[model samples]
Target: MPSTLPSASPGTLQLQPDAGAVHLRVAGDWTLAHYRHLRQAVERARAPLAADSEIDLSALGALDTAGAGLLAELIGPARLAQVGRWAPGLPAERLALLGTVAQALDQPPAELPRAGWGLADLLAHIGRSVQNLWRQQKQLLGFIGLTLQTLAVTLPRPWRWRVTSLAAHLEATGLNAVPIVALLTFLVGAVVAFLGATVLAEFGASVYTVNLVGFAFLREFGVLLAAILLAGRSASAFAAQIGSMKAQEEIDAIRTLGLSPVELLVLPRVLAMLIALPALTFVGMLCGLAGGLVVCALTLDISPLMYLTILQRDIALSHFLVGLGKAPVFAFVIAVIGCLEGFKVGGSAQSVGEHTTSSVVQSIFMVILLDAIAAMFFMEMGW
Candidate 1:
């Protein structure tokens, strides 16, 4: 038929069919301007084309890449090759463009293989997690070793000490933390005393509340509370401070200037914590005892004089020493973990925040774990 397909643009497609062959007469400004009509016409005519069909582009006008692509898609590589064998009427430029489009379309689309929800996937996930944990532990051990080496190298050199930095870190980690540590220990001591008095009053042993508070605070509560608080506060602060510096490339600058970051940044914080934690532990012990004293006076009706008498008679000096002795170890571990996490930070704000959180978690875990191990050792040793 000579009839043009219905359209709103200058593009037109006329189909003429004989017994053995079909002819597609394309006459249009087959550019982006008529792309919609051209696309619709191609879709409508696609089903009716015979295996022996010819595309007559002799009447085609104003072709563009988009139109050529559409035409290539409609003809397909096999049918276009068939047309080339018989018709040979397409212009050199149009034929080349169509050939290029055909070659591009000949490529197979890439697709990712779908993972099956099987035991293999579950095992793989667990394997990856375990691997990550082992890697992290290895890195942590290496860092601890490096820190110890640096400390050994620097300790004998009096002039190498960063006294100013150490003093500043002590003020920040120790002095600044005193109030909270004291208050928390005081509150916990009061709670313990109250619980002790309430339970012991039934047995006419309410007066023993002071001894309970003294023993617990002196041997465990004071140092443990201070260590946990510092894990949350000072450890996080160390990570954030150093992590920010790392993100800003100041760590690189230090390296450029031939200053060891571990000596300048880590040693000061470690020394400060070693000095500060014991002092804080001592303050926490006193405040906790004072809280117990207040609770005993108010609720148990035990006078301050009687409370001191009982504490002095029952709680030995060795108990205080045990608690104080754990402080430096906890402090060193906290400082090292915090500084290590900070140094691991990548160059981003998100990385700084992540490492800061990691520092707090690792510090707290190490402190609690070490305390438990120490407790077991002391118990077995009958100390």
Candidate 2:
């Protein structure tokens, strides 16, 4: 008599010597729970498994992907393709699992190349930077052309002029800024006069301090100072205002109504700057000369009469014209750069701040660069 009871078992492999080949029998659960012992069992039995071995899966139990992978390690990928002929009793799903695992294990992932720190890398970085700068300049040039085209088309009609907006921006960019611009130029003028007096006095020519102050302010410092001030002050303001509007989706709404943002938002600011900057430059020149005069009266004891005489004798109208002429160009570039940056906003507070800072930096750099070029041109042309 035999007892009829279910038995618990670990995975096992047994080899039997047959007529001309070996019979390899697999049994029990080939799962994660039995992975360690199953692996060791397969390792020990796998030595006898050759191309002509017989695989008996009829006695095989449960299986999973881990076990399938271990089976692959034992059988090798080439044998996995012919699993059907080797183990005819194996289920279709189990055959598929074994094939998949064998393929995955056979083809390992390739490694990624690491970056190097060398001269080639440095040159590559510089090339990328130059490309970015060129792209930015192209955008600026295109924007300028678009603004001019719009101006040409719109300015011919008096009815479409944005008078109220222009007035408001003019006051903000020009009139309200007068005090600060004037004060800054005045202080700079005084410093220049002091330095001139000190240096010239060493050569017994302290009286030429008046001529130095007049020539400096009339030809360079006056317009340069005013433009730089507006770049920092008004350019940031323009970028912030337009950026906030963009972030709030007001710009999108404006476009939905078929309104031109360039005309309504940008042109007014640009025209205002165009009108205000020259006036501001003139004021800056006067204020700077006054500051120099005061410094000379106090430090060098040069009379106001003598200072005027020296200014009239030494400084030509070309110097004044040269300084003032640069104002409109500076004004237009600053305004365009500011508005362009504003339009570039990504509809977020952080993006607005970043563009606002960018506008100011770009405006100042352009002003200085254009001024330098203009100086060289005037000097070459005998102005």
Candidate 3:
């Protein structure tokens, strides 16, 4: 048995060494108030504890969680348990509390393994990205094919047509869009004329600004601007509208009522876009030309009559046809992409917003890509 040590003050430790063991005597207020001294004593007593050491907690007074935690850390959990077993004279509650703290502080938390930065990991990431891209392309193509199939099936049944919905969509997607499209194309036309005048004036060819504006607006800029604006405005609107219905389970409800969502919801919007875009393109062309005429009159001193005469003489009918011909194709693509994205929405408001944004981005990208291909084809064929 270890020799009895002298009583230590509150927040103090007394270490008494025996032949082969040490007795750790703790007494007084072992609490937050005396934490500093208790911590120092615990630290000093740490080196003396061995496998044969014993902790005597029977004399301890006013023990709390913090002091118990410090004691556990110093003596380690295994010896702390032995101390509890040997010192039954200690309060049961205090020993139980010490055991709880010992268990909690005994082990450190496990760390997560870091990812490898080897060539195999890099190649795997690239392969996953490629697979995702391929999957997305397949989904888009399948959607396009479905839309076309629905159109073919529905076209022969005039009795099934929803004229009111078609008219409403036309007014919403087309008539509502006119002012902004006209305004944007008009401003762009004026800017183009100004640029042409500034650049060509160096070569004493300022009058060519009229021809440049006429050619650009008729062949490219007018339809391109209108289509891009509709992509941002109308495509997003379609996605949000259909996505909201999807979130509410309204599409499923429609199907339960023996109605086709594609025919009822998508066809009207698609047809409306197809009809509206051509009219919008025509308006954009006129507004663009009017803007160029105004710039010519003010800056180049070219009268309206001379501008019209020059335009008629230099600009061919084929230029206008080339631009107008692309409108229906662009409109079809935008409408289908928007409705497809909307149908893809999951049952959440966040899903609606994400797919809406995606619809706009995809529509704009497709329109630009198609326009570029058409332009290259026309150029190669000398159309």
Candidate 4:
């Protein structure tokens, strides 16, 4: 070769001899002109370094696919070793093409050193998880805050629209739930009376069966059973409704119209359930008491008059109030869990269905757990 390589801009090539290494020098950007000269130089040196050849590309300021493709070709068929600082600002598409060629030739880039585990890594992972949880909490709170604001404005303006939602939710949650709640409560009462009668009759205390059924139903069973039913019926409905809206882009449409779906959809339903649950619980209590009365009169031969007197003596105003108080709390919990799962609905219809089912099941589980905690607290306080 002449003092200067004949072909390209201002790059000189120097061959080093361990096995095969080429030092490529360049003054400015290495364009296609430099790449052609690089190939010619490699061809001239190939036979001499047949066992191994390394093309060092670290000096180039810029390289394109033409250059990368040429390097890929030599590294593959010629079994050359490629060592380089690839140019910055290389297009992703070109890099991907080069990676594919390298992979096809079973020439993987060298693995970088692994970082050791330390306190820093543990803290980093924990921090990320906490941050994610915080973000979810913020989203949930934002939804509630925005819902309250929108309802404050809309309820004063078009309050009647909310009434329809209330009616709809009550019809779905309360009316639809009545049959199951009534049947279950009735059976529970009958079971209680039968058990009390069986055990007490031997001791000549069968009349007290009335007191057992009345007290439990009035204070605990009525509210607990009603909450469980609503958890299954209303919570699932809320999740399915909201999740479907999310899946169908209805929530997005509400946003586009400057409306909060939480207000228009969720708050009304929650309000309705709050109002309806107490009434439903009260009805369920009455049905349960009636069932107990029937069993007491027929099995124990206690007169209905005697049953009523015993119930009146055993049940108190505070007992009724406690059950009533629990209803709204249960309503709030079911509404929150349902709406949370609903908002979790992803872009797919399958996600909508899966989350709706999970919402109902999870709400039921939470209701039971909360009820147990409440019972413990109340018992500790001598309730």
Q: Indicate which candidate wins on lDDT.
A: 2
Q: How does candidate 3 score on lDDT?
A: 0.89
Deviation from native of the Cα of residue 219 in model 2, angstroms: 1.0
lDDT of 4: 0.74
lDDT of 2 by residue, 239-323 (tens): 9999999999999999999999999999999999999999999999999999999999999999999899889988899899999
How many residue pairs clash in each candidate at the backbone level?
0, 0, 0, 0
lDDT of 1 at 221: 96
- Expressed as tens digits, the lDDT of each residue in 1-383 for candidate 3 is 96444224566788898777897777787877677877888888888778677667767887889888888788777667655667878887887888888777767888986676788888988999999879867888898788789889989989988899999999999999999999999999899988999899999999999999999999999899999999999999999999999999999999999999999999999999999999999999999998998998999999999999999999999999999999999999999889989999999889999999999999999999999999999999999
Q: Which scores greater on TM-score, model 2 or model 4?
A: 2
Measured against the true structure, the TM-scores of the candidates, in listed sequence, are 0.80, 0.74, 0.72, 0.67
True lDDT of residue 262, candidate 3: 91
Clashing pairs in 4: none
lDDT of 1: 0.88
Rank list by TM-score: 1, 2, 3, 4
Against the true structure, candidate 1 reaches a TM-score of 0.80
As for lDDT, the candidate ahead, 3 or 4, is 3
Model 2 worst lDDT window (10 residues) = 2-11
TM value for model 3: 0.72
Q: Per-residue lDDT tens digits of candidate 4, residues 213-321?
A: 9878887899888888888888888898899888888899999998767777888887888877888899889888888988988888888898888777777777778
